[model samples]
Target: MSKVRAFTILEMLINLTIMSIIMGLIYFAYASFVKQVINYQVSIDEQNELTTSYVQLRTDFFNAERIVKSYKGFKVIPYNNKEIEYKITDKYLIRRQVHMLDTLSINKLTISSDFNIITKEDLITKMIVETTLFDEPIEFVIAKDYAPNLKLKL
Candidate 1:
């Protein structure tokens, strides 16, 4: 009688072991890819938020009737009487105005200014916002040239 060919028990176990190892490797690779994608998405969202916040801040600065430096950030007094205060920290910047608030998350934040007056007391002609995103440095400078007579109010 001819013996029917079939996989031996040892061969079957070996096949299963190889398959398990391959599957484990594939799972690990997939997990890593997913983690990287998630991180990339988070960074993109943060970048968008930072960009939008900067645009709004620049608009406020341009239209501000008066700007005063506060404890950490600055305050913008618009002509319509809606006073906006920006509070900055290492991690976030918060813009508060009347009934609304906007928060921007940042890795690092630094604010500086160019003074037009020699006294350097609230005579900020240009305001600079410096930050870093994904190891790339970014800066936003907003300048408002005030009339000589209006220097004190600004």
Candidate 2:
């Protein structure tokens, strides 16, 4: 006679339990990875916004015909007849035009802001801008490129 052997009920149960534990561990690892990715994306978006705002400001200040301090913020006059203004109100840095009511503003992440202007001469000016984000401070300075008395021209 020949003899045969087969798996017992207890052995099958043990195998299933081991598989379930491995799957649980994999699920935990995946969840943690997803959370970290989300956090990194948020930080990237914030930096992008700050860079955009700073670059736009530099362009405006560099090409401005004149910059003046106003009650709201700054009145930047360009070569054209149109007037563009930057204002700080309601905890936001706002950009708007003189004849229009439409406004564009910094996102809610910005907590504080300041604008300063110095008329170096009739055709030259110096400007400094400071703003706070996520409890961190950032600053920018711009010197107008046009002047006549000192032979510096547009």
Candidate 3:
């Protein structure tokens, strides 16, 4: 009789089982890696958004002619016979500057804040504003060189 060259039924079954196990393991690993990458990307995006928002807020505060106490969830600044109000509302940092003889409508800016408090230690001959992002509770520290010397409650 001629020698058999094909795999036996038992050998084929074992080979198929081994291949299935290997494929399952590979799929599991791939899924795990994908999840990790997504999580990391989300974290990075959040951090970048927080940084950008904080910088914009800091810049506004630094350029303001005054920084008054918090009123109605806002800080008022008097500039050129007009009032500029900075406040946190609905998970946004809004600035409403009312110019003389202008409509009472307020302008809106995209920003947010957290439960962060400003400390004197973070000031360098200027006022330091610290806050957190709306989506995140983590605090952000911001400093500006121009201090308006507006009296405010710590």
Report model 1's TM-score to 2 decimal places.
0.75
lDDT: which is higher, 1 or 2?
A: 1
Best by lDDT: 1
Better of 1 and 2 by TM-score: 1
lDDT, ranked from best to worst = 1, 2, 3
CA error at residue 46 for candidate 1, angstroms? 1.7
Expressed as tens digits, the lDDT of each residue in 37-62 for candidate 2 is 99888878777776777787677777
Instruction: Predict model 1's lDDT versus the native.
Output: 0.77
Better of 1 and 3 by lDDT: 1
Q: After TM-score superposition, what is the CA distance of residue 93 in candidate 1 from its true location, in Å?
A: 3.5
Q: Could you give the C-alpha RMSD of every candidate to the true structure, in order shown? A: 3.9, 6.5, 10.3
Candidate 1 on 1-154: residue-level lDDT in tens?
9999999999999999999999999999999999999999999987898888889988888888767676788888877878899888877788998889898766565455444365455644566666777778787777766655676533
For each candidate in turn, the TM-score is 0.75, 0.64, 0.56
Candidate 1 local lDDT, residue 128: 63
lDDT of 3 at 58: 67
CA lDDT of each prediction against the hidden true structure: 0.77, 0.63, 0.51
lDDT of 3: 0.51
